[model samples]
Target: MASPRPFSRYEFLIAWRYLRARRAEGGVSVMTWISLIGITLGVMALIATLAVRAGFRADFVDTILGANPHSTVSYAPSQVYNELTEETYFSPGTIQDYDALAARIAAIPGVTRADPAVRGKVMATQNGQRGLGDVYGVSAEAMAALPGVVDPERASGDIADYDRGIAIGIGLARTLGVGVGDRIQLVSPDGAQTAVGTTPRIESYEVVYIFSAGRWDIDEARIYMPLAAAQSFFNREGVADEIEVFVRDPERVDDWTPQLLSAAGERGQVWTWRDAAGSFLAALDMEDDVMFVILAILVLIASMNITSGLIMLVKNKGRDIGILRTMGLTEGAVLRVFFLCGAFTGVIGTAAGVVLGVALSLNVDHVMAALNALTGGNAWQPEVRGIYALHGELRAWDIFRAVALSLGLAFVVTIFPARRAARMNPVEALRYE
Candidate 1:
């Protein structure tokens, strides 16, 4: 053990004075400032990138799970041999006993709700404007229980009136230039059969409610109507196209697939949310990995600045180091002092970055809004991004990674210069001075 240990008061005091030197003192203060700023900005950029990526993922997932079913069980097409045609033909899938099937699914453990729904495409028109709409036929109870449909913040008009009228998405409302209590005409080509041919089923229903599902595609094309109304309109009075299943944990949907498949038997097949959005999610994951690697390289480049700063400091202080060594200062003490100088910059820069990164991530939407207001233009287009605003989320693990990266690089780069200072020959260092 030594009398004065490493990182002692005097070591730190000497490091502090060296760090605070002016331009006239051959201080290398300029390089110090530049390196410190580089580290700070690098860390901030890394944290902010992680937060934004996480936000995009969360936003994408929330919309998927909130607005769409975790899994869909639809009747599977079966091959039937027809004697009249003397050939086998595939019959279109339709759930004849939907009520029983939905009940069976709802009884399964971890299952939340099973809704039998009729789905179809129709042209919606109002005020001489027409847009294609995807209509979902669900019972009033199911509609009321839906997270996206019943969200108080995004939903308007009385839900109780939904039994008599129909509900529409905000995007559809915008397209038709209508609001709550307005009437919209739904025209479907697959309609009632007459002697001559099938006629289009055209019905006008008041838009009793409007909801935003936090997704542009869903909001623009989704419509909901009472089960009875949809059944009568679509000529599917006794059956549903499929059953939408909800569970306690959507992330664990694969775990429940076996149960769903077994319950469905040969009558139906299961389709999970993962199957619906797997490609997009995979792309996002690849993007996140690539972005992280690129930013890590940036951090390393920024950290190299620390090496530049320290080398300059060492060269300028060679004479001082030699004098200190002659005055009973050990080489270890010299090393510790320079190490402290570099370490201080890293610690302070990293701390500042953490604060700035967290602030930027937590308030990304607000910051974007301010920028949009200042520029008199919208930056986050909901139609393009599938979300209303930029979602930014800061995870503890991300912050830790950023801090570790900055400090680790700083420490590694400082070692090279610190060793050079420690190994300088006193005679050689002071010969020129």
Candidate 2:
């Protein structure tokens, strides 16, 4: 507040000279450039990796919730898991009137819609091909709410009216070598009990539509048919296995449980989308955290180069420090000079990394596509069992965190060397010169 120009200009000028000086002047050394580059790469890697992880988590959650409902109003059994099969138990003790239950749920606040459905695993055979898939019986209203239907027109009408038609995912359709209008045989594991023994219940269904649900698991193994057909085929007339409910805010699904449960009545129990897929989501988050910790070590290693370079710089500038001190430069000013030099590297490196990381993250999909084209193969394809594609999302907060971490380390490492340079004895330092 006293003088606007009270800050020392000499320190910064000297620091700038040191940063730009060539090897001949014993100012900027090879180690300085190496340190800068190392920090840049480390920051870039952190941003890119974190961005990809964030994108994947978001995509995974969206795909999972999109293909399925946010919450399901089902007859709660003793236990519940993600996988659904024909042999999976449906609690007979709960309300069998799915229509009434669904209506009740739909009337709840924060509830968007509800649709009754029957789900089970079945063996599908078409032509000479055979595949195992999960089949769902849903009303037209319910099917319309599902995600990733390439041709909604085909699925918009009352699916409950079709007694001989079925909708299948694109992957399942491909595997069975069937298309729209093609006939496929579905064999349920829950067989009929005759005098001889239990025999598999088989039925032929004509494929009326094909859909891509974005999720590999769903796309590869889900089929939809009329609710009445499913109920009849499964020998559970006048009852549905579950009622899927959509909410206004899927993220806060847990908050709406009490209302949904109350509407579902005492015999009914509810399962949110998170309940079915929470474990998988948790595993992804854990993997991302581990990757972050591992990548942070690389940044730490790069910071070491900054420390080593600063130490060397101080040693090389010992004679200069002695001369400057004798010329009335304060110890604090001497400390400032070296600190600025180190900070220059850290700041520039962080800036460059942020730019590079953002550009790379935004264009990663295009870059991978180009690489695949060049290689004539899908080199960048996701090989995980349930993952269908690679996704990327860049959060500014993540970049901020990475930048702060890198700069903090760089700043901390600079202090020791700067202090050593400041504490130098003028007489002893000049003796060698």
Candidate 3:
């Protein structure tokens, strides 16, 4: 006896024949075109939305990490050591046991580097321009370990002296209208009166190195000086405002915080970037959630097209269903054939959408550039900085989720139509003119 034809091949041919017949009908029914368009629009919207969210999260994280240390250890009440002012010339609080604390923290599994830092708020003035910026006094070696703290070639010579050198952010420098060899006045909050009763506590330093951390916050208001200078300015001797710790992985911030606190002893509290920038981070997360829900509606509306298209197919194929049932084909097989046809439409539409979405995500910058040219002005400037345009990195998980959702929605839309086709009475369908 001849072997029965493979079920897979038969199913494939049946699905293809139906698909081709629909296409050849010259002007396919409006419902069919609508369904295809719906799937295409839904898939494209999902992929694009996910890509933008991923990009925004990445860019925001980079900006935050660049501006602040991964984790910091400071005295709980007030980390600022206020006793060792330049006038008092008194010894300030020291680590008490610096070497021991360092050793204990370094032994922790994920600790990369731990260094002392002097933090103070100071008013910087260049010519008539003035701004309040953080003055971070760090050891030369410690400066090297901190992220985004590098001396640029143009200003290296200014900082060569070390004693009178100060590094200012590029944006800050621009606003102040100062550069290498320019004099800038630095005023500390603490001032003391002389024996005659006149307050005298102002100092001037030459603008040395200009650093750019690629973040508006850092570039707009950050200054670095030698630990000793900061110590003298803040009157904190042998003591530091905080101990900055670098970790191997930022995601493990909470894991390392407790370890740092233990090592810092009872006098200090450890704070992560997330803790310091809690509100900002929370806002970012909220933004992501809102965007996801809003964009998902676009996909949801597009899926309706799939439902309408499948209903139309069921009506168009009524006669085919009757013939197949009379030929001894089971209701289940008839149902499966139409289900496969709907799924095929979803698959093709989703594939095309993925390609289009990925291409758009990757070239978002170029697209913005063209728009800017056409508009003769900067448009689509959602980035943290106005200097550059926004671009999103496509994520694999996002793509997978998008395609799965599209196909799943297609399957759901096909069910009722497939079932109706299966339930058609062969005699009645055949009797109809």
Q: TM-score of each candidate?
A: 0.94, 0.89, 0.85
Please give, for residues 1-433, the per-residue lDDT of candidate 2 as tens digits: 3422322687788988877757574534777888899999999999999998898788888777767889887766544443656365544543477788888888988889888888888999988899888888887767767665534643333334345588888788889987778899999978798999888999988887787767777877888888888888877778888888899999999998998878877667888989988898899889888988887889888888877888888887889999999988778888888998889889988888888988889987787678878988465543353656666799988999899988998888888888999999999999967
Q: Say which candidate scores most in TM-score.
A: 1
Instruction: List, residue by residue over 85-131, the lDDT tens digit for candidate 1.
Output: 89999976878899999999999999999999998999999999999
Worst 10 residues of 2 by lDDT: 153-162
Return whichever of 2 and 3 wins on lDDT. 2
Q: After superposition, how far is residue 316 of candidate 3 from its true place, in Å?
A: 2.0
Candidate order (lDDT): 1, 2, 3
Clashes of 2: 0
Top lDDT hit: 1
Candidate 2 C-alpha error for residue 36, in Å: 0.5
lDDT score, candidate 3, position 142 = 70
Better of 1 and 3 by lDDT: 1
Any residue pairs clashing in model 3, and if so which? 84-235, 85-235, 94-238
